[model samples]
Target: MWSGAAHVVDAMEKWPSSQEPTQTAYGLAHGTDLTFFEHLAGNETKAKHFSDSMTFMQSAPELRHDFVHEYDWSRHARGTVVDVGGSKGAIALKLAENYPNMKIIVQDRAEIITHGPRYANTNIEFQAHDLFTPQPVKGADVYFLRWILHDWPAR
Candidate 1:
């Protein structure tokens, strides 16, 4: 089925006539007020596919290695880091492996949290959070926004 591909096609076709382009072509095509993640709440299969796709893309060894090595995550050792929209805690687990002392809270939609990953690392945790809402966890040492922000408008 080209259902997913259809969304892409629809986006391209509707881009020119969209009322508020800031909402994005996909948003316009779907005509929904809900943010991309919020819409997933009502569709478990789509939600899983989306979250799993994100996990798969982000789990690439080279990408993880670059992120882990390029930056010095050790500076925030023993501190709390909130991984926003961190589906399945893939990066959080990797970060935990290298920086075991840092407490990591991997947050995503409730749908994602329900199927979050399991790990032996005590420092890493999975949490259900909607980023569109006010952030519940305050004053974290670091707020890691991996593969999440690009989906929204700059404004």
Candidate 2:
């Protein structure tokens, strides 16, 4: 697996495949490039792949420090937070640990949350949802959307 990743990295160095392969292929074949969201929207798996990748990416210990100390979570005590597109409830669990009094909703696709732990505690709840539709949970003091914007190009 490591060797395969190295080969991919070497290939990527030669050509930036990681930056929207569909767009690059479209450009090479038709002399026109579509936006990232356009490419993602066309393929249903794009959203799932992107979300899972994000969940895996956040597993690195270094990433924890970046967000943990970056904000003052104490202000949100006794408040409710809804984590949109939250996979595996990692961030929601962290928030629950930080602010025990606050309530949390870990919202993601049913396929992603399938056979996974719903939430870390009683203060948290997991709901399978499609964010493309109207947001189901409301009145949240904070709607956590960590690293979600980069998944889609700005319209």
Candidate 3:
């Protein structure tokens, strides 16, 4: 996390007058044309570490509790919950455990999708998807996009 924070700092320092620093900091730190995740996709160890980090963040009890209490799941009884950019389906699994009537779909990049099945059960399903594209699962009762959009700056 510290390294990521450092990267954010570095990116902020390099932020252009009229543009965000994602591409610049990414290129500076990685010396590649690819974005951070794009670079990680080709490396197994880094990819695993990234996924583990996301899982660690999601495993926090208070975070889960806040989400559970804040959202009115009862209103969407027997509905489908699509967890977009869900790293390893951890939150979705938790939701499934609590809301037995609701079905959960965890979607993320292909690199993270492979690890999803390990955490999935009958009530939770995992799909490989890039959130930049149009959502494939139409008419979901809820599309939960937790901590996802900040990765990209508004164009």
For each candidate in turn, the TM-score is 0.79, 0.63, 0.83
Is candidate 1 or 3 superior in lDDT?
Answer: 3
Candidate 3: 10-residue stretch with minimal lDDT = 16-25
lDDT of 1: 0.76
Better of 1 and 2 by lDDT: 1
Residue 145 accuracy (lDDT) in model 1:
93
Report the C-alpha lDDT of model 3 over 60-94, residue by residue, as the tens digit: 76654567768788876699999999888778877
1-155, model 1: which lDDT tens digit per residue? 13435466566565654444344434554567565566677779878888787778776766544688878888888899999988888788778888889999998888899976778737988888889899999999999997777676555
Worst 10 residues of 2 by lDDT: 1-10
State candidate 3's TM-score: 0.83
Q: What pairs collide in candidate 1?
A: none
Q: Write the per-residue lDDT of candidate 2 for residues 61-147, one digit (tens) a residue.
A: 776545655888778889888888787677877778778898888887676666346653468888888777898777788888876
Report how far residue 12 has shifted in candidate 3, in Å: 5.0
Worst 10 residues of 1 by lDDT: 17-26
Better of 1 and 2 by TM-score: 1
Clash totals in order: 0, 0, 0
